[model samples]
Target: MQTFTSYDGTTIAYRVWEAPADAPTVVLHHGFASSATGNWVVTGVVDALTAAGRRVVAIDARGHGDSQKHHDPAYYGEDAMARDLVGLFDLLGLDRVDLVGYSMGGVVALVTAAAGRRVRRLVVGGIGASAAEQGGVDRNSLVGAALIEALLTDDPSSISDERALGFRMFAEATGADRKSLAAQARASRHTPIGLARIKVPALVLAGVDDWLATRPHVLSSALPDGRCKVLAGDHLTVVRNPEFAAAIVAFLAD
Candidate 1:
């Protein structure tokens, strides 16, 4: 568990699995409320990337995993997350990398790519362009609030929404810091952005049934060099799919 200090003095944690020195390195960003281990390592993403002869650098976003956790909403934003990645790259001396991000991490990747970071290839999953355009309370804010309420009150009965309740339960089950996650949710909002600045080849992938990331083709079309692909299962299950790993390996290899 390697650690680096972000520009804002936030401690960030990351793990590097080395491959051949000449092989292209891939940096992975996990979804909302998930750690690098939960989203990438445990899901076999690290193994697949390593097996394909690629070096892997997996990050635990602020307020998730072993990284520094903050309950202040000021600590999180799409730009903040992007800055964290940039700091990680600078700390590790990574000149360029293939960036793979899922869900909330996908938004961070887009922000980073748009900011002219050294991303050679971008693979975004469980998100769409509409997400990049929309501005409002995110889908997870309610869940975060519910989790916060439950955590503060120590009573699950306070949450009314079933989806929010489930999220709270999952967070509790996973031993997550509910306050920090809730703060993250409150701070994160998808603001409209132009994708024309991103010149790298990108692969937009998601589950066919993922309503949260509707119309991935729209996102792909926005990119100068982008394409979309759908796999079986919903957003949650698709991460466990072997095809997901295979597609990424093939795309990067190409």
Candidate 2:
């Protein structure tokens, strides 16, 4: 695992799987409560991309994996993680590359694209337009609070929401930092104002059963060069599907 310092000097963990000289590089951002390895590596995404003749740069977002975990909500924001990505590129002297983001990572990538970063192509998976507006998931809500409580306690009966319970279980099973994830709930909220500003080719991907995500077509229609693709699974299952990586490889390959 390689490390890089972000704008705030927060240490971020990343790994690079190099492809052939002519192959393009693709940076990957995992979803909330997921690490780089858990998202891309274990899901067979890294191997798929690498086999497809593309270099893979997978980053563990702050508070998610081996990276620095800050309990302070001030350390996180809608664009803070995006800034980390930009800083990562700066540190590596990489001017441009293909980018793929899932769930929370998708939000960061969208914000990065809105910032006019040098992303060659973008594949946003497991997220949609609601992330840019107000109707998306709320971290401080009753359900979120319940999830945290479940994660902190041994008694699992208190978590009524199945999704929240699933998250708590995943976090515990993965030994993820619960407090840092709580802070992430407060920090990650995107409010994209100018969709037309992002002129790069983008694929807005979602699962057919992912009701958690907002309308993917809306997001695609808003962007200057955006299109929608739906996979066959829900939010949690979609990332693990080989089709997810296949869609990304196809889009970036073009």
Candidate 3:
């Protein structure tokens, strides 16, 4: 695992799967409560990118994966995470990269691209129009509160919301730090992320059955150059789709 110090002195962890030197690098950001391995590597994203002759850099966001974890709510948020991503790019001397981010990472990607950073192309997965219209990641507000409660609660049965409960179960099943994730949940921001500021070609990819990504085109239409495509499954199963990587590879390659 390679490491870089973020702007706030946070230790961010990333892994590089090298391809030919002339190959373009693709940076990947995983979903919330998920690490690079869980979101990209295990799901065959890294392998697909590398096999396609592209150098892949998969980063574990703060409070997730092998990155530094903290329980303070102030330390966690998509804005902060986006800063870390930009910092990594600057630190690594990456002039430009094709970025692919899923779920929470998609929010971070939107924030980064909206800031007019050095992204050549962008692929936002598992996110929809409502998220693009409103503040950063819409953990759904009330749904978000339920998630926080589910993460910190001692009894799983107490979480009545099926989605939030499932999230809690996924976190536990993955052996993630519940406290850090809770802090992340607590820090969910509603600030508007200016997607219109991004001027790069982007692909809005998601599953037809995914609730979080209900109307993919709403997000696509929001961007200057963007389009939407949906696969067969829901949130969890979407990444497993071969077309997921195929679509991303094709989009970034173009």
Candidate 4:
């Protein structure tokens, strides 16, 4: 594990594995409430990529995992996380890297790649037209408030929304900081995402049964060089599937 100071002086945590001299490096950013271990390492993504002769870099986003926990909403968001990624590249003197992200991490990668940073390739999953329509799950409004309540409230039964309840249960099971998660919900973006700006080759992946990633073709059509691939499973189970890593290995090998 390694740590770097982000733009706001918040400490960001990451892990890296080296590959052969000629192989490409891949960066993995996890989803909300998931750490690097839970998202990529335990899911067999790191092993798959490393076995394919590719270097891997996985991060534990601020307010999650081993990273700094900031209770302020201002400290968390895709924009901030994107900047942290670009900064990581700069600090490491990396020219470019193949980036992969899931769920909330997907939004961060999209925003970073769209800005024309040092990203060579992109693969974002657990998202779909929501990326084009609502900037990839913009719960910044009432829906976001509900989610915040789900994260902060003392009583679990108070959360009426099934998805919100799921998030709460997942957070508790993971032993995550609920207050920080509430701040993250409070900071959800309300603006639209400019998908057309990303010029690099991109794979907009989604699980066939994922409700959050419906009609991924729309997301693919929106990007300059994007294609959609749907695999078996839903949002939670997709990353654990062997085909998921296989798809990413094949895409980055291109």
The C-alpha local distance difference test score for the whole of candidate 3 amounts to 0.87
Of 2 and 3, the candidate ahead on TM-score is 3
Shift of residue 179 alpha carbon in model 3, Å: 1.0
Task: Spell out the clash pairs found in candidate 3.
Answer: none
Per-model TM against the reference: 0.92, 0.92, 0.97, 0.96
Over 38-72, each residue of candidate 2 has an lDDT whose tens digit, in order, gives: 88988898888888888789899999899999999
- Per-residue lDDT tens digits for candidate 4, residues 1-254, read 99999888999999989888475579999998999999999899999999999989998989999999999999988888888888888877778889999988999999988886678899999888878888866342227767888999999988998888888999998899999988887776646778888999999888898877888888888999999999999888999989999999999998
Candidate 1 whole-model C-alpha lDDT, 0 to 1: 0.82
**Global lDDT of model 2:** 0.81
lDDT of each: 0.82, 0.81, 0.87, 0.87
Per-residue lDDT of 212 in model 2: 62
Q: Best-fitting candidate, measured by TM-score?
A: 3
Question: In model 1, how large is the Cα lDDT of residue 33?
Answer: 72
Give the TM-score (vs. native) of candidate 3. 0.97
Off by over 4 Å in 1: 135-153
Q: Write the per-residue lDDT of candidate 3 for residues 1-254, one digit (tens) a residue.
A: 99988988889999988888474589999998899999998888887888889998989999998899999999998899989988888887898899999988998998888886689999999889766776656556337778888899999988898988888989998889999999998886678888789899999998999988878899999999998998988989999999998999888887
